[model samples]
Target: MPANAVTQIPAAPADEAVRHFEAELRFETDCWDTHEALSQQADPGFVLLDVRSAELYAQGHVPGALNLPRRKIIASRMRQQYPAGTLFVTYCAGPHCNGAARAAAALARLGYPVKLMAGGITGWLDEGFPLERDAAL
Candidate 1:
């Protein structure tokens, strides 16, 4: 038998896997879940931030998401816009882009709760969600 990549490394024990997966949920949310939360609830309990460039953001971005590029995630700006207890969900172009992660890190450093929207814009579109265009800053 040949050694294949799938089994090259043994899977973690059930208990370890459970803990790892549970922890991941804390830092990530999928596009479908994000869309559901936004559409179903009047107060979704989190702010969705599009961390792409202003130009890209204007072209098209997740509905209800504010265009706040990763570099523009300033502590003072965030504080002024949202309360300290606000939870921030950030997304970028897609899986190929790390803007969401960068924005999440910035938000965390500013003492805000943050989560990365896995798959980002690509994921949102894949889920058949609509994007809002010509959004103002």
Candidate 2:
């Protein structure tokens, strides 16, 4: 492997690749769009779940996110609380963190509808969205 050489492992057909990439892109954009809508209170169709710690959530969080730490999510808990088929958006600190993935995975395993917000709070902040906090903040 030469330092200046380019190594190509494999590639999908251009059209196939385009469609796959577009779908992936759509997933990300759709998550953001859903967040934007929820933040604006336009529709209450879904839930934004903050998979971070209580402290983190207290400091700041997405406007309408519900704090349900990654470790605490369980099928029984969800069943006892929320309805059976609720749409949920799980988010964490940001791209650097995996809390959202952890939470989403748990929810998925329990047959819950869940989407991981691409960038988490960092992404929201980057998009210039203000954080909602407890009265202390």
lDDT, candidate 1, 51-74, per-residue tens: 899899899998889989888889
Q: In model 1, what lDDT does residue 55 have?
A: 91
Candidate 2, superposed: residue stretches over 4 Å from native: 1-11, 22-31, 40-42
TM-scores of all predicted structures:
0.93, 0.82
Q: Which tens-of-lDDT digit does each residue in 56-125 have in candidate 2? A: 9999988878899989998789999889788788889989998888898898888887777888888888
Which residue pairs collide in model 2, if any?
Answer: none
C-alpha lDDT of residue 32 in model 1: 95
What's the lDDT of the predicted structure labeled candidate 1? Answer: 0.92
* Clash tally, candidates in order: 0, 0
